[model samples]
Target: MKLIDHTPQSLADYTTAQVANLVPDGRHQALREAIGRHQDEALARTIACIDKVAAWRPGEFNYLHSSQYCQYLYYLANTIWVREKDAASATRLFLLNKALNGIDLFYEIAMPAHFFIGHSVGIVLAKATYGDYLVLYQNSTVGRHIDKIPTVGEGVIIYPNSAVIGASVVGDGCVVSQGARIVDRQVPPRSMAFTAPGGELALRPAPEDLLREYFRL
Candidate 1:
């Protein structure tokens, strides 16, 4: 697929409205300003990476042009946004931790304009619809099922190895525990979902008292 940088044209260029709404209005405006200057930074970094890649024999690096150069800038610029955006800041730190430690985050997928990378690495947010304040940890996945969209409510916590998919409605103030799998279902507000035998599931007040503390906030 051709990667087009439409951020300059419209907010829709980044991702869906759901994802964009996750970022605070103030922060979103800041991101807009930062993106306006992204081209310059991207060009510089792209040229450097190109030169480094070029040293690895012929055809290792794609030919660079003004358009391609801007595209490079767009990617890096998004990375910068990811680094600084709310919630996503944690994710960026996790990314740095993985990079410095030589861990692989190949499974991580982030849609453009989806802010809050807080606690990112080891997290796999695939083709899923996310709401605001979506706090996630390592090994979490919002997977896809037959092209259906999973709806996650605001202020939700998806812990390690927790998988929710198939048009499921993950309610507000919910905490999905480690190693749990929820599919094609609706989890109520202020609840915890756990995996039971025979592909069954259980819902109860989240094990952690702090899980619902923010509901009052």
Candidate 2:
């Protein structure tokens, strides 16, 4: 799917089809074509970032691995190239924009076949290993440091301002406290993770009963 091979007008039409499930607008096709014709030069840096991240994964080649990471970068690059104001890089962007306003789906990122989000903003997800029903609040980060990947279990609630870094596994039904920081550790299920003194981490019953509030059906 080389985008440059097609005419700018045709590329716009194709982009509309690709994102129609998220944003359905008859004029979006024309808008996309105009952006391609006018903004191709401006989107070069983002395109480079996408290409760089696409080939740098450590996992084996398979649908689960590639679709979750590599293909995401491809879609992200093209989406941002077409829409320059937003920083969203996946499906979450579309849903978020749809929720924020009645406007078309804008910028977002989300894994395929993942849990639903009623609303989202300011969320950052890294290339960490994740299980089902992973709910995240705004400003949460699942990231790495010194060549380590985080492993997140099912039904985890990462609250706002929380960060889970380095190699760690947050077990099922856990709640990471708002403004909490995690690094290089394994957390038990149904537990509460919070930040302790000296930037360390501690566990206790989640304040406000976060697990029951966010994870329970």
Q: Which candidate is the best by TM-score?
A: 2
For candidate 2, what's the RMSD? Answer: 13.1
| Model 2 lDDT, full chain set | 0.54
TM-score of each: 0.47, 0.48
> Candidate 1: which stretches are off by over 4 Å?
1-36, 39-119, 197-199, 207-217
lDDT per residue for candidate 2 within 60-102, as digits (tens), equals: 2222232222332334443563565433333433442334432
Per model, state how many residue pairs clash.
Answer: 14, 5
> Which regions in candidate 2 have their CA more than 4 angstroms from the true location?
1-119, 197-199, 205-217
